[model samples]
Target: MKFLVLGATGATGGLFVEQATAAGHEVVVFVRNPAKLTPRDRLAVVAGDVRDARALAEAMHGTDAVVSTLGLGKAKDPANLIADSTRALVEAAEEGGTKRLVIMSAFGVGESLPKGSAILRFLYKGGRATFADKAAGEQILTASPLDWTLVYPVLLTGKPSTENVRAIDLAELDRLPGLPRISRADVAAFLLATAVEGSWSRRTAVLTTGR
Candidate 1:
């Protein structure tokens, strides 16, 4: 399968690019700085910003699917940042006729916000702008015609993948049974699998580490 990864230079997105390349999938990564991404077999780089829909659409040729790991990146008003990027992505995907989309979202963005622990709720509330932005992105995906899966992961970690990941419903978010931190590698694994396999289609899945 072929993939176009947004924000492919970030930690989680970089892991997706590496793992997808290792798995023998063709990859085209859209980034602002192509120099940040090292050349690899089966990997192609497209230089562009996430907010550039025309560029994203142009890069979407021959793309079997898309994986977005976009984040705020030190923006003072993060809501607009995510919302604009998400809108551009949705438009580009539609224009390019790319249907499959797997996006990484925060756990506290939408329905899961009220179900979080005290600290989690407090943090999300404190950072409501960012969470609201993510919620807006989710709304866009929800309304789009594309096959989409929104994976909402709790606090992310930098550990290597154990592949012990599970996606629970948002209704079960507050009652999670194990550690809340999920490794970026595990998240990448789940995203790649979902994009290729089409499981959990058109749903909001909360991703977390499980034994």
Candidate 2:
């Protein structure tokens, strides 16, 4: 599979690139800073911003699937770059005839999952602006004609892959008290698996440790 990964320099995106390449797939990373990526035989690094549709189209040309792990460090800011960038990516993919897109979103964006205790929610809600932005991006992808899967994970941690993750639907999610966190590597694995197997196409799933 030829894969186009946006946010390749990001923690989750970088893990996706490494895992995808190791799986013997051709991976192209759309990045603004090429120096951040180490050169590898199976990985092609394309230096460009996600807002550039033409450049994205060029990078996405002949790609089998696209994955976005784009993250904004400051969630309190009013700007929503992910939403903007993903809209551009949708256009580029549509024009380029790519059908599959897998994007990362936080767990509580569109669902009523009680992802945190009262205190945690109160603390996290400071970034409501950012969550709303991600929610908008998700809406765009959901409405598009492409086969898309939105993988919403719980709070991310830097642990190793346990490979014990499970996908829960909205109903199951609401009953849980903030889904168990999984490693970035496992998240990457799930995304790549979804792309290859088309396991969760046209659906939004929350991923977490099955604990």
Candidate 3:
């Protein structure tokens, strides 16, 4: 499969690119900085901004699927960059005639999870503005004609994958008492698998480690 990644330079996005290429898929990275990506035969880098629909469409052309791991830094303003970028991506994908889209969003952005501790809820409340942006992004995808799967991952860690990840429904997720953290590598792996195998299509799944 031919794939286009929107946040190729990001930590999770980079892993997705590597895994996709390793899986023998043609990977095209739409990124602002091309130097950050390692040289790979199956990887192609395209320079562009997520806000520019034309550029995104150009990069998305001839692609079978798109994976967006776009995010805003903590230091950034509350302009909701991810939501804006997702709107642009949806428009670009629509124009480019690409149907499959897999986007990553943090858990507890829109729906309340059950296992969140006081600290987690407090932190999430503090960053409510950012999560609102993510919610808007998810709304855009859900409303679009494209076949989209939104994966809400819990707190991300740098540890390697344990292959013990499980997908929880919204109600089950909300019933939990504490948030579960998953490795970024595992998130990437799941995104790649979903893109190729079409698992969890048109559904929003909360992903986390069993432990």
**Cα lDDT of model 1 by residue, 84-140, tens digit:** 888999999999999899999888887887676777776666778888888887888
Q: lDDT per residue, candidate 3, 98-134, as tens digits? A: 9999998887777753357776776677677888888
Candidate 2 residues 1-211, lDDT tens each? 9999998898999999989998899999999999999988799888988888889999999999999999886555848697889889999999999989999887767664364545546655766788888888888888899999989887789899999998876555545453357788889999999999877888887887884
Question: What's the lDDT for candidate 2?
Answer: 0.84
What are the Cα lDDT values of the candidates?
Answer: 0.86, 0.84, 0.85
Output the lDDT of residue 116, model 1: 69
> Clashes in model 1: which pairs?
none
**Candidate 3 deviation (Cα RMSD):** 1.7
lDDT for position 14 in model 1: 92
Candidate 2, run of 10 with poorest lDDT? 170-179
**How many clashes does each candidate structure show, in the order listed?**
0, 0, 5
Ranking by lDDT: 1, 3, 2
Candidate 2 positional error at 144, Å: 0.7
What C-alpha lDDT does candidate 3 achieve relative to the native structure? 0.85
Of 2 and 3, the candidate ranking higher by TM-score? 3
In model 2, state the lDDT of residue 49: 80
